[model samples]
Target: MSNAIDRRDFLKLAGLGGVVFASGLPGFALAAGQDEFYFVQLSDCHWGFEGPPNPDAKGTLKKAITTVNALERQPDFIIFTGDLTHTTDDPAERRRRLSEFTQIASDLKVKTVRFMPGEHDSALDNSAAYREFFGATTYTFDHKGVHFIVVDNVSDAGASMGGEQLEWLAADLRQQKTDSPIVVFAHRPLFALYPQWDWATRDGARAIDLLLPYKNLTVFYGHIHQEHHHMTGHIAHHAAKSLIFPLPVAGSVPKRAPLAWDASEPYKGLGFRGVSVDTQSGQTALSEFTVVKKAQANATDKT
Candidate 1:
């Protein structure tokens, strides 16, 4: 359970042979006063990745933590969408980078942090290393009557949910009450956003097909490194900006690349989002705020 709650209502969510967490999950009794809750969503930290798009890449994630901690209201938890670290084929380097990321993120004021892997973090060796650091790439959890499904689409040879995970998702949904609000978090866009950039998930259509039956569903993902709003039928999907760098809008150029850094306003296309749920009123509010503002980012770039 989150630190915001008085008592943890443990629930079982099936995936990776069906494990139980001390935190929220399906079948867990809703906590008292759970009608309203909020959490932060961060993505594409790329902790060990360095590139020209972000001259101050080293301090990217540290700045995010400081910014989140200073929010007007502390969130119940923080959910990192994916790409916790940059991709590296070297196994030892992968472990070292991920471990370092864990340490830096631990500095956050919020303790209930959920992690998934992006292709950069999980595409190597079928996500074996990612699982070693963060358990269960895909699973379901509940918070304030909301059913949240965290899916793994960046592993298994490419950005695809694959057959086994699809089956698990089906079984999980079958057990949930039909009217429950559903929110999905994945690293890749579930729909075919842009195949040329390797932005689309190969088998995402099948996943969306399964979710089409639900009355209330939404997906929050991180990969494109920009703010985007898309819809697959009634389900709303939104992508959050990356802490590292921003990629060009899909198909805007012949190939996908990080947008040329706006030197005049460094860190212009970078920020994090806060998502709040209001169960009694049946609504959610999302806000995007920059982690490293212009002045702060400018100073960071100098050092």
Candidate 2:
């Protein structure tokens, strides 16, 4: 199968090569005989954040939890892509933010929640604090006939998944069946999204090479703080929006930063994404929805 995204768009978003990679719609739908599982993808909460990026970052996270709790059909599990806390080396600060994040989960309606590290969460000390609070740098699990791989793509300085993680990725995929539907979760996009601003993964090409043989694969990530999709062969790579704030589109500006919202509608641009996986048909479908915070009650009332 050819890559899903066009060469021009890839160059524009990735700011690297203008050469066409490949082209074809990779199958994400379930195969003929398998059970279906659905899940939610949330990213970049920055639990310790306290700024105009969005007033009351804590409240916005609470709103996210409430929204997930109220989903009409609950997901099989939840995956938080990364950046659970703001930039900080202080263990106390990290602990506090993690505690707050965990509190939000106390009322969660979903049974499982998986987490990965973002540059911000790991920048200070190889994610020492985050790992202490969470667990594991990278791991894999199988559910209902599908393979789920979570990778530690961020380095101590906020770089992409480096040599060590890539090696582990190759070994991990070697054990899975080629035909099995694979779902990879990470903090940064694996494909070249924009190397200029550190949006693209450093050694992502090697990671993609390992997955090229798989007939069915999908990658879900957060860190770009927006919703975007690119396809490479049979693999579809998606970046989820941040729970705290949104960023400008790739290359839209000289540099990327979270866009500030008007106080009246703080949660205006915040939302979560839903991914439905059907093992039976071997298909994965995505949809996004914004959550209304308590402070946005009037806005919701108006709508």
Candidate 3:
């Protein structure tokens, strides 16, 4: 008997593969042939932080903006991973911090900007004030055939996703196809990086399981204030660096506070990440670069 299968036979075989991909193969195939899209990932800006760890936090953020604006190729959008402001229990202070943060954001040349809440900005009353200014705790957006899911993994008082967000995540992943390229973003890492300092998400394993069925899945996060990568099977998790300050490596120190800088080179330790997502190749690349103060940058330009 002939072994060659016809289109009808292929469809019949696909039935056993599951319903998630049965209705999505055509769309996936169409998407696989399209061009890739790129985006910028900036994290832990801490716009209101005013301490020795970063004496020029505001200036560094502006330098980062300049760096992004000077990129050889502009990204399709910008995703600020979180910690938009410093901690403040007072509502007035929180609002003031947010206003200052927005004032800085207004200078951003990129039009489409996505924001998430970190524990610092979400603290005291469950991010009520943050939602009023930034809108929505967790949400999803589709860009160039890929699904981008931004979750609220950090709790109001701690690093956690809580039960409600987990349920929403399960439902959301259930709605996506198996072959779709899924990119998840949040403040705290979904995997346990270092629980001693509250660096990892408490119920992150459940979230990881929810994404297990997808073939091309990547999770981007910021909270540890450094760069790290964790892999669980096909899903890859990346922790982005902070624009304000860098943190000690997990277990490297007794505490997880931001690293103090040398006065001689204050901007040496501050940086942001640029992420390039290639859907056609199913590959993503992240590059980290520190912000140089305009004067320092200008000094280099003259040399």
Candidate 4:
């Protein structure tokens, strides 16, 4: 399948109680008869965020959790890419937000939920508080027939994955066959999407070079606060949308500020994503869900 997101798929939304699958991804061939498993990705929730960009910031995260719980088919697990909470200069407040975010996330019905840090959660203090709440910054695990790698670029504060982590990644990849299906979870874009806005990881190109040999590699990341798809050779990079609020496209304006709230289009560009992997055919389906439907948006507009 082509890497380009189909126009129809990009425009599709998860209406009140619906999920719309996007075009399938090619080259992930698993053995015949293997069952399909999917996971939900909720990124950039920014739990403590409160501002004009999202008037209902406090309620959005809970709504997303409710939506995921209400899915007809629950995911095997759920992963939050990054920015779990808004930045706070006070270390005490930071821990409080992290604790609160964890408490709320614990309500997720899935068996396993994984998390990584965004700059907002880590940069101020090298992820000390985040690590106190979450675990290792970089790690790897295997699910069924696929290998998953979680990279930490935000911890460095310089937006680089760092040499030690790079070595760890290289050693880890050495154990897997070049053709093994691999999925990487990260906070920032590995490639230079827009360096001016800090969208690109400083030393991410090196990590990308290390991952270049993998045949069925895909990356899911969040930081830009929008849904974006890109390619680095054979690897596909997908950026998830934010649950807190949406930001303008890369370089769309002179600044990287969050887009203002539109009373008429409440929750317009805010939601989570569902990624389904078909082991038999190696096809992956992406589904986008809005936090609120038309009626809900309208109702919230009145509030």
> Per-residue lDDT tens digits of candidate 2, residues 200-265?
777788889988998778888998888887889757788888888889899998878778786665
Once superposed on the true structure, which residue ranges of model 1 sit more than 4 Å away at CA?
1-34, 280-282, 300-303
Per-model TM-score versus the true fold: 0.86, 0.83, 0.84, 0.88
Candidate numbers, best lDDT first, in rank order = 4, 1, 3, 2
Q: List the candidates ranked by TM-score, beginning with the highest.
A: 4, 1, 3, 2
Better of 2 and 4 by lDDT: 4
lDDT of 1 by residue, 171-212 (tens): 999987666677889989999999888888999999999988
In model 2, where is the ten-residue run with the lowest total lDDT?
A: 18-27
Q: Model 4: per-residue lDDT, tens digit, 89-140?
A: 9999999999999999999999699999999999999999999999888888
Please provide the root mean square deviation of candidate 1 (C-alpha atoms, Å). Answer: 8.6
RMSD of 3: 9.8
Better of 1 and 2 by lDDT: 1
Candidate 3 per-residue C-alpha lDDT over 1-303 given as tens digits, one digit per residue, 9 for 90 to 100: 332223333334434421111221211211122365567788988877887777676577877887777765567899999898888878899889988888887778888988988888886768888898999989999888789999987644766677888898888888887887789998998888888988778888888888888887888899888778788777878887888888899999876677888666756656666655555434565556667543574452321
Root-mean-square deviation (CA) per prediction: 8.6, 8.2, 9.8, 6.5
